[model samples]
Target: MNKIFLFISFALISITTQAQEIKWMSFNEAVKAQKKNKKPIFIDVYTAWCGPCKILDKKTFSNPETAKFINDNYNAVKFDAEGNEEIVFNKMTYKNPGYKPERKNSRNAMHEFTGFLKIQGYPSMVVINNKGQIQKTIVGFKTSEELKKEL
Candidate 1:
């Protein structure tokens, strides 16, 4: 009985520890949510080949306080800088017709939205207001504390 109790305790502890997560949505969903709630949008633009992007995902975005703050305050979106996903924002349909699967890990063509935003580098963080206007852009990796200030 004692062994079973210990196992259940450990399982509960693991579940609680894993609950801290950033709720990332698609850009379209974020736009719809913004229309209803008037919350700002936070976009994390990253390519798969960027090392600093991975670090930001693992360290800053995964932090409990950071996740909770973003979840509560902003409509978060994770955008692949080189991906082929279609995004419609501000009466524009953004697509990457030249995206090649072979160049998934290497330097591929940028998504139309990325180009539209004039993102010069990977790991760019964009803050957009509820009115669909760009607020600020932070290029490169930032710690959780730094991101909190941006929030």
Candidate 2:
């Protein structure tokens, strides 16, 4: 009977831990959501080949406390800096016209939106206010504690 109780308790704990994931959305979806409910936008701009970007995802964004705070206060977006997706912002359409599909997993053309934002490095965390204006841009990998303080 004690063994069964322990198993049930562990199962519940696992379920609760898995439920703390941050709700991530695309940039366009975040923008549209802001029309109904205004919230600051947190954009994680990363490239596939960036080592620090992967570390940031595993260490910082995956933290349960960090995920909860971001979900409660911001619309989080995961954007590929070199992706070919078309982005519409501030009455302009941005695209990666020079993006080569063959080089997708490696270094490729930068998205026009990335140039518009003037991002200088991978794993950049861009904070946009509820008014759709940039608040801050933090470059490189940050621990969960460090990222929480910034937010």
* Candidate 1: residue 3 lDDT (0-100): 100
Cα lDDT, all candidates: 0.91, 0.90
Cα lDDT of model 1 by residue, 37-128, tens digit: 99999999999899999999999999999988998989999999899889999899999988998998888888999988889997999989
> Residue by residue across 1-151, what tens digits does model 2's lDDT show?
9999999999999888876888889999999987777898899999999999999989888899998998989998999999988888879999999999999999999999998888999889999888878999998899999998877
Model 2 regions more than 4 Å off: 1-15
Residue clash pairs of candidate 2: none
RMSD in order of candidates: 2.0, 2.5
TM for candidate 2 is 0.89
Badly placed stretches (over 4 Å) of model 1 are 1-15
